[model samples]
Target: MTRRRPRPYDRELQNLRLHVGHERQGPVPVGWYFARFSRHLRRGEVVPVTYMAQEYALFRTRGGQLGMIDSQCCHMGADLGRCGRVSEERLVCGFHAWEFDRDGTCRKIPGAGRIPSRAAQRSVPVTELGGIIWFWHGSPAPEPLDELDFAEDRRRHLYLAGEVLVCHADLLPIGEHVTDASHWAYTHSPGRPMTSVQLRDEGRRFSFLIQPADADDTRIYHFRPYTLISMASPTTAVAVPQPGPRPDGKPPRMAFVAAVSPVRPGVTLATWSLVVRKFGPDWLLWPANRLWAAFLWRLVRRNHHADFDILRWMRPVAKDLWSVADGPTVRAYRRFYRRNLPPAMEEGAEERVSGMS
Candidate 1:
């Protein structure tokens, strides 16, 4: 059998090997319904976006679809997000009254009385599901976004059981931890070795079963990594670029979902949906859920602290090492990124992001 090693020139992995701290690289994946922008943005609103190290304006049209373009208006360098309006499925720049469609095609120019030949805003494809907006970070695909649905019900996600964890770190590393089980002690550890950890990977999605090293250890953990595995448990987990929409429409509920979104060069946001179900007694569902919820929130917060302890300051890139729990899953994910997304817009690759190349 042949062993697989990462390409020698993969800069993202190389930087991780060299331990250069935190840097945002890699093309953001397609089909991810980003909830980070869902809070303040409503239909017919535009929000400035500086995600994946590129500048963009994410506007929700009245029809409830999302449209994206370079935040700067086509006429002058005014930030469209600051004073942008949506007229039907288009965005009207407050600066010049320029109107652009969902694909950034300029349809109305008040001054020119006709759309100029070069009056179009750069178009980025967008779709929405689960009460969240999603845009592709790669060349547009030929499928409609309604076909790209979220596996989890982002709309009805029980609020008491969930919280969003934001940090100034790129999302890839944090998202990768879901499959890297042995390292549980390094950060979210209970200060004891997990009895046994096993992983199963089925291409786009993978899961882990974490067990305490000893039954005699006899310690109960509020948030055992076990329940965070899939939809079967009272707990469920949905990671980004998670398994595509299910045919049965019964996507596994997630106990924790880390949806990654970029804010700027050195800042990133992850919506960590930590869902904790109530006790078996139906009567305890209300009053008891609160304290239990707080305990779960603390678990998530501590885990976040453990992650940010290094991620908050370290600029990390991928390093090709498959020596951890279910290493193949991590390798597969990295392969997916390198295969589907274009090179990260670094140094001077900004044109690629803005040009839709």
Candidate 2:
């Protein structure tokens, strides 16, 4: 598909999160990545981050610890992220040399004789894991990254760090794309859909059985038939909690995982990763090699990037949803979002779209 470059939205609608109520953004989760991607930040550095619907400042201390607080300083409401400097594990305000410790306690005010007990700024918890820094958005402690147990076992698979890009759009399209199994038949296949979809782990994991190779079948989506039976088991195709276990008592061929965070109105940032087998063919089937893992990663990356243009501009509207079979799968996620996460926008603050109702 030919891709179109993203055009900027209306100026007034840029910071949609700031103006709109949180409820309209859909059950926007309160998990990590609000500081967008933070593993790159080092000590004594102050950076501004927009999370969910608000902007905040992140500070790194001397010993490689991170703290999240409001971007504006408590004193005189100065933009702390602009000129703030760290002083011995503390973030000092640029305007008045006000120093805040890793806990956000305003310990020093320079010439001020008395340090007010209320001078402290409330902070969100921060944790660095697996090269990504996670920060809690709400009051509770941030949950550690839901990493796969298999990831720790290096003997099984080799992981390739992939691309990270920011998009200006909503996530509903993404939710729809994954569940739209029919698209596989038209865009990625030779007019044949997936053969089976088995739910596992209380609907958290999935096992997709695609139609095996045929002479008439053309693999447009980069989905090659499993040449190796061990690496291509139908047991663990695409899962949420983790890919399903190999029924043949083996590891996965590769995995594609991506997440999108809505930080501003008409703006979002996402992270992606691909993992494959560390070694070449193990028990054998069709004489496959270790490079199969990397090949799968490239295919996954190509397939997703093909949709980037549409994803960046697709608006989340009820009228666009199409499906009967996949409805339950997509709705389940939205239901969980509504019940657990807060809405991303207020009803009145939503962007006024004209054509696409």
Candidate 3:
């Protein structure tokens, strides 16, 4: 029997590559992203902010209101964040002394007699809640935020466990990792695997409840959710243990809220805040919670740090080989992203298909 000569090395490799991988860029999800901590920006200070792969001029007016507008001055295209000053509740361009209102309407032109209709700058909607500032992306008007959801956080007696900032190369992996139950054991907890999970898919907000394998026998434990993983938008998530005395009578785990914004296609900035409910009498509550927050912070920080290297370098697989281990929570997260892709992405996909036809 004569053996045929082996196929050319390059051609064989190319065939294998075609069958194994073909990566394409996908649209990024956009919505309200946490921009900055409210305390970071003082009154009458204008600063440059980069988010959603674009630049913005963020400022706090003398009247204590936050304003975000297009960074480029409409008059002569000067960088507003660098050459802007806040005066009289308006943002004044330093280059030509042109003044613009918080709404981005050109109010005054020093030399020019009248402000032209096209001279106005584009304004972005910004709101501050619970000392966190959020900016709307992809639209001029912001969607309504549920104030009731954060009632406990706004309480004066609450304790802040401080903030964490992590830079990611790509955001999809981190977003999906928020609710990935199987990875909990290996990535964060090590041995305590996730035993039960409940997913709540609420269109824009996807949430899930996770219970560890080593959980105690607390009555109505399954019915009463322990932890909440909420996605405010595709880029923001709030992960916190449910508020209650622990089964062992220990203080509950501190809450963590992580918000993400894309600095560019492959770079994402994630901001995290750790919080714990205050306990004890009002006078002692502050000091006690402060100490408690410090302890809780260490616990949450460890888990967060474990994910840093993994998430930073992770790449999307061409095809996911999911298994039974990847439970309902992970499946729901994938389904949510698929069903609620950004409107721009949906439009582009349609255009591509139509052109092919």
Which stretches of model 3 miss by more than 4 angstroms? 1-26, 139-141, 152-168, 213-225, 243-254, 280-284, 347-357
lDDT of 1 by residue, 175-282 (tens): 445545556666775766653333444433444445555545545464332332431110113532123122223433334454556554545554554544445444
Query: By TM-score, how accurate is candidate 1?
Result: 0.63
Model 2, residue 293: displacement in angstroms?
8.8
Task: Sort all candidates by TM-score, best to worst.
Answer: 3, 2, 1
Q: For this target, which candidate reaches the highest lDDT against the unseen true structure?
A: 3
Angstrom error at residue 201, model 1: 4.2
TM-score of each: 0.63, 0.66, 0.78
Cα misplacement distance, residue 118 of candidate 3 (Å)? 1.1
Q: Worst lDDT window (10 residues) for model 1?
A: 227-236
TM-score: which is higher, 1 or 2? 2
Per-residue lDDT over 1-357 for candidate 2, one digit per residue giving the tens place of the 0 to 100 score: 111222222222234435533534433434454243343466666776665666567777777788887767787888666667777778888889998876778989988999988887767788654334557654445554433444555555555555555566664444335544545555554445433233332222233333332445535245443211111111112222222222433445555545555665566655566556555436663235445766776767786675666665666775544455342434433432333342343232233221121
Model 3 scores a TM of 0.78
